[model samples]
Target: MIKGSIQEEDITILNIYAPNIGAPPYIRQLLTTLKGEINKNTIIVGDFNTPLTAMDRSSRQKINKETQALNEALDQMDLTDIYRTFHPKATEYTFFSSAHGTFSKIDHILGYKSTQ
Candidate 1:
C-alpha cells in the first residue's frame, strides 16, 4: 500500500497481489481495511486473481464469494472499479492464459467515484 496527498486532498493507493490457488479472502480484506482508514480518496490497482463478475473472467462459473466480498467492500467505500465503470462494453484483459488460449481481466483500478 502507498499514500500521498496533493494540496488538501489525501489519496491512498494499493497494489493487490492475490494467491494463485484457493479463495483469496485477502483481496476483500484489504479493501475492508482501506475503507476503514479512508477519509475520501483512494486508488486500488492490482491483480485481483479472481474476477468480481463473470465478464471479468473468461470462465463460465458462478461468481466467487471473495469476489462478491470485494464488490461489497468497494460499494461501502463509494469506490468505482474505473475500468469497468467507463468501459462497460469493452472487453480487455491484463492477463492471458497460454494453455486455455484465453484472456482475462484480473487487474483493476478502483477509486472514489468523484475522481477520474
Candidate 2:
C-alpha cells in the first residue's frame, strides 16, 4: 500500500497487479498480502491482471473467480469501482495481447465513492 497525505488528510492507496503466471487464488493472495490499514480512504488502482467482470472485457464471456473476489474485496474495503460506475456501457480495454490478437480491460482505478 502507498501512503501519503493530501491537503493534510491521510490517504493510503493500493496498486494491485495480480500474478498472471500464478495459479488459483491470485486475487485472494494479493488482497491479503498487503500489511497496512486499508480504510475507506484508501484508493486501489492498477492492472489487476484479471478482469473484474464481463463489462470489464470486450468479450461477453464471464470470468467467475475474478468477479467474485473483486466484488467481495470491494465490499470488504467499502470501495467502489469508479471507472465501471461511470462508463457503464462503454467498451474500453486497458491491455491488448498482440500475440493472441485480443483486447482486454483489466487495469482500473478503484476507490471510495467519496474520493471521486
Candidate 3:
C-alpha cells in the first residue's frame, strides 16, 4: 500500500504480484479484504496472472471460470481497467509464453470508475 497526495488530494495505491497459478481465488480473497480500504482515489496495479477477457489473450479459447470470477469481482468493486478505458480497441500484450507461443495481457492498472 502506498499513500501520497496529488494536487492536494490523498491517494492510495496498491501494487500486487500474484502467483502465476491459482491467482483468481487469491485475487477474489484480496478484493474482499480491500473493500473496506479502497475508495475512489485508490489505484490498484498488478500482475494478475489471468486475463480478464478474451481480447487480452492471443488465443481464441474460451475464458476460464477462474478468470471470469476475477472479472466479476473487479466489476463488483467498480474498478475499471485504466488502459482499456483509454484505448478500448487496442490489442497490446504484457506477457509472452514461448511454450504455448502465445502473448497475453496479464498486468493491469485499475482505478475506480468514478475517477476515470
Top TM-score model: 3
Q: Each candidate: RMSD to true structure? A: 2.6, 2.8, 1.4
Off by over 4 Å in 3: none
* Residue range with the least summed lDDT across 10 consecutive positions in model 1: 31-40
The positional error of residue 103 in candidate 2, measured at the CA in angstroms, is: 1.4
Tell me how many clashing residue pairs each candidate has.
Answer: 0, 0, 0
Candidate 3: residue pairs that collide? none
| CA-lDDT, candidates in order | 0.73, 0.71, 0.89
Instruction: Name the 10 consecutive residues with the lowest summed lDDT in model 2.
Output: 21-30
Model 1 clash pairs are: none
Q: Across residues 1-116, which tens digit of lDDT does each residue of candidate 1 receive?
A: 77888797877777878887643578767666666765457677887777667787666467777677767877877888798888887667788889877677878887778744
Per residue, candidate 2 scores C-alpha lDDT tens digits across 5-108 of 99999988887776675422665566656524666677778777766677766666777765677577666756677888898888888887787676778787
TM-score of candidate 1 relative to the true fold:
0.79
Quote the positional error of residue 57 for candidate 3 in Å: 0.8
Ranked by TM-score, the better of candidates 2 and 3 is 3
